[model samples]
Target: MTKVLPSLLASDFTRLGHDIEKMEAAGADIFHLDIMDGQFVPNISYGMPVVEAISRTASIPLDVHLMTLDPEQFIDALAALGIDMVSFHIEATNHPHRLMQRIQQSGMKAGIALNPHTPVAHIQHLLAEIDFILIMTVNPGFGGQKFIDTCVDKVRTLDALRAEKGYGYEIEVDGGINQETAEICREAGADLFVSGSHLFKSEDWQEAVREMKQ
Candidate 1:
């Protein structure tokens, strides 16, 4: 079954607790949190305080995506906050294996994210070390961007690589993921879908989420 992870970036911050409760009730598998630093992604998103608050109310696992210059700086803090998974950009770290080890040691699943332009071959060696790979369908800075059509092929490539190498890392796709794009990725072997604006802006989140899962 496909796992639908609703990105909290697009949720109403004023009613965060209520939105989280509604999403949980609607059967969202994971709560996708986007953490950004001004330097790395050209946008600053919520930090530990917001995440900590979300953790208090979020019943599902927190899938934290760190779009920062140095993701290692926050590993210990995020782990201490009880984050279930932490994904950092492959371009941001020189020693990704060490980071992956550190995250696993901290009892969190480690993930590597690839920008739309990045090739799947870049992280082939570390495939077995991480828990998942985040394929950014659009640029990583902000939300509501249109999906880059070429990224669907990247999913296919990663899926084929996983099959060929017998790896177990989950293929998660973010950015512009709605019901239509989710189905496209699913056919290409992406199991986890991170949707933001589409899910949050809908009048019926339950039906919206259900449609994405289908």
Candidate 2:
């Protein structure tokens, strides 16, 4: 089954606790947190404090996506907060292997994220060392962008590579993932779906999440 992870980036910050309660009740498998630094991505998003706040009330696992330069600088801190999974952009760190090891040693699942413009081959060497792979369907930084069509091919490529190598990493697709686009990704072998605006903006979030999972 494809796991649906609602991006807290697009959630109602005012009613965060209530929103999380509703999403959890709706069967959300994980909570996706987009952590951005203005230097790496054009926009800056919430940081540790916000994540800590979310962790206080979130019952599900926290899947933190770091869209910042030098992601290694924050791995220990995030892990200390009991984050379940930490994914950093492959382009963000100079020491991918070391960073992955640190995350694992810190007791958190490590993942690598690829931007829409990045090729799948870039991280193929480290696939065996990671737990999950996040493919950005839209450029990182902000939410509510249209899905980039070519990203689907990237997902297919990663899925094919995983099959060929027999790697255990899960394929996660983020950005512009709604019911229709999510079906496309799911068909292409993506197992995790990160829905932001489409989910939070829905009149019936429960039905929306259910449709995405279906």
Model 2 earns a TM-score of: 0.98
Tens-digit lDDT track of model 1 for 1-214? 6999999999999999999999999989999999999988999989999999998999899999999988999999898889999999998999989999999999999999999999988998899778999999999999999999999998998889889989989999999999999999999999899999999999999999999988
- Candidate lDDT values, in order: 0.94, 0.92
lDDT, residue 212, model 2 = 93
Off by over 4 Å in 2: none
Clash counts per candidate, in order, are 0, 0
Query: Any idea how many clashes model 1 has?
Result: 0
How much does candidate 1 score in TM-score? 0.98
lDDT of candidate 1? 0.94
Assess the local accuracy of residue 173 in candidate 2 as a C-alpha lDDT between 0 and 100: 96
lDDT of 2 by residue, 74-174 (tens): 98789888999999988888899999999999999999999999998899789887999999999998899999999999999888888998999999999
